[model samples]
Target: MTLRPLLDPQLIYLEPAVRAYARGREILARFPQARQVEIDSHWRNPELYRAAAAAEDWLKLKRDVLVLGVKKGMTLRPNGRSADFIAPSSSNGCAMACSYCYVPRRKGYANPVSVFVNVDDIVRSLERHAARLGPKTEPNTVDPAAWVYDLGENGDLSVDATISRNVEDLVAAFRAIPNAKASFATKWVNRDLLAYEPQGRTRVRFSLMPAEMAKVVDIRTSPMAERIAAVNDFVAAGYEVHVNFSPVIVHEGWEAEWRRLFQEIDDVLTPAAKAQLKCEVIMLTHNEALHDVNLAWHPKGEDELWRPDLQERKVSEGGMVNLRYKVAWKRRWLDQLLGWMAQTMPYCTVRYAF
Candidate 1:
């Protein structure tokens, strides 16, 4: 598909000037003939105000209909340890522009978070596939009893600025699928979800980082405190809650920071809530290290971590270098993190991402 540069306003500077420029009105005027317009939430960064303004300009031009799309292929792909399926959501517009965002490097810098207005087509495709699989039977099972689907496996789900607009549609679509379990993974704390009754098999998974790390690297995202509080709210509403500490960036005092963060999570969870918590501690895998410097956080000697077995792929922005951990190191790290979790919250079950 041919993608056009709708606009290129400087995100950092233009955000404050949005009202002054009548950006929304300008967008409405410019793309009047366009079928749909998508405003990426990532551009909301004050540092990227110019970009945001450009996006806002386009959004205003067209009162586009928004539709959530689903990946027709296998949703679950292997990450570290657990496999995850792609749920129905926007492409991949993450609000937090971390220095080490893997999406740009591994998947390219395209606005994956843009709403797929062809969502109805996507659902129809899924229904067709299900019908082709044949009727459910004990000897030859085609229609599985439980289908687990994860949202935003390629990006964050509840990036407040975008989710508010798209979540209701996502909830409605997934609820229509029988025996389907949908999970949304996000770094932001979305309390609004608590208000909606659990529809379909939807679950909210939160990807948390240390408060200090989040402050330093997770630019433009919600704070750790808010995320923890939101998770508690989800749990109280009787929703399944999963915790992911993926790409666990190692910095000085990381251990202590992680310990404190987990403790905070434990403090808020009720006994039953704690039992339902599925926690995963994932270290940085090579697949996600492609756009290492976009957020400006790569180390000086990062090449040392590269391995020959890892695949190298060239993405839209630049080259991506991936590396897998040595078997021994993987086991060692998993042991250390799981051991810590056991000591801190013996009741919670912890899983390591391979």
Candidate 2:
């Protein structure tokens, strides 16, 4: 499939001041030529849309940021499981334009790739946040004095080799904070990570798919076998590795395909590796703006009827659509998979997004 340019909604530039000795200052200096061009309003640009469709040399240079914070004047959730902060930190702000990607529809940016030169600042921000959380004195609970940070929620860390190097920097900073841990998730097969020694505070999670399904759905990404091999390498290096079998598309012969995939994992992964593994099966959900866009991408009858409750709405003046599967259907598959894992590897902890 041909790639398309993204329709950006807004364009903003951020240049934060830094102290001379601050590690973030060095990172910020690397991006002396960097810029943040928000695509939150790009759907209104007809000319940009046309250009995105026709240009092969079109390179978008901008950083995308999504920020979410706890609601004010409210206590933490009664269940105490919800995160206080959730955001996406893009090492490379643009994507590789996979057909299954929902980024273009949601953000309206046409360019699918842009590498960030200033990831040091991003790592410093994470360290600063974690430091505020205090040092860990007890297990299974954040020390009243430790800060907890989650990295790479916005985009893949390995999108660029230089950006992936920041993972080590992040690990170093977090190690200073006695109770802090950082999480990074990626689909890229980063061999460099296997070669470098991590500080043991960073948790690496690989978003994976079966080989056949990856061929069909994961364009511009490493093949499944290579990714699995990388996973094995990371496991051997003593890193805490988690596997996310996310957005489990329910296509024809899905059950058999998943069974084969699990079998491969069971056969190759070491017992200690399996014991350290955390598996999560995610159900797809999109904002309202993505519904019609996705429907246009895939006609109603062309794809499986995965979700019936999908709806259409305009995010701005530009029309867009979002889709979601029924919650009950998602839970059913999650339960079944967890049950299978329980039988196959009872020591592993399997999780699901409901």
Candidate 3:
């Protein structure tokens, strides 16, 4: 049976500059039934944003709207943990509505998938940046062989694949760049990506959490088991695979749940996948604004995320008022979780953890 379309857009906000691009045109053809509106800028849709922000149905906009625009500034920024650098986005926003997601914090109320149709320019910008870096002379936490560039900082590429060829194009582009590799974290499992032929030049970090906990927070994403089950296949398909224990929500029995999660990963991954496996652990960092937003749409998640008793306020480097597990508790949790990972999946090196 054919699965229904993941995104059946009812309206497309198109930027005139990108209307003629092959990617923009393809997206238009894909959603021929959707109403189209020409907008001056994707970022300046005041009326739509205002209406969506006022409504409780933020997800309704995510489900029914799409945006196509040219990515104006293609600047690469330094990142030391999950990747060496954050590349210009191939797309922004996401269809899967993870309640703790940081993307929607800046995007106001509705955070639908916005495809930057000028993919060739984004790829060219990467090529230029990588050429300037030349070759990696030293190994870093991100990679031992190449400069790892994060391609999906704002969206899930696996979900992005369903909308356009952007992910495939970037994967193919990196296949030839010997000194730079592309990486992205995703909670969704789009097997369509397996055919992209990354040739070890792309790393797919499967974002994971305890199965039951995931249901509470990871809205509309692939089940944890499906992401775990795809590990070996992704490895066999010539892409490096990793796990992201991200936004590691600390609730009652979270330690036990995480231990069980690690054991499952060890049990299911093939020897080859384990050999190449590494992981990054990021404890939950919740924003007050996002907490308010979640309450409106997914209050149940706030039970797992927003904790006044256990969490303390900390301003992020980006200047957002964020809540983090209190220092002593976070330290203890990180150490305990690392210990569990060591005992359960020793072969999976922790590239970074916090």
Best by lDDT: 3
| Candidate number that wins on lDDT, 1 or 3 | 3
Shift of residue 344 alpha carbon in model 3, Å: 0.7
User: lDDT tens digits, residues 1-354, model 1?
Assistant: 974332222121112222233323343344355343233333333322333224333232112222123233433332323323344434454444554456655323323343333344445554444444443333211113544555566566565224233455555665666645456667766666666666435677677877876765565566778877776678777567777776675444667987887798788777767776776677655554433433133343243223344323333334444555555565776677677778888876665454
Model 1 spans with C-alpha error above 4 angstroms: 1-84, 87-89, 106-112, 127-145, 160-165, 286-292, 295-319, 323-327
On TM-score, the candidate that comes out on top is 3
RMSD of each: 9.7, 7.5, 1.4
- How many steric overlaps does candidate 2 have? 31
Q: What are the per-residue Cα lDDT tens digits for candidate 2 across 217-268?
A: 5655667777666766787875667787765666567777777777777777
Rank order (by TM-score, best first): 3, 2, 1
Which is superior by TM-score, 1 or 3?
3
Better of 2 and 3 by lDDT: 3
CA lDDT of each candidate?
Answer: 0.51, 0.51, 0.90
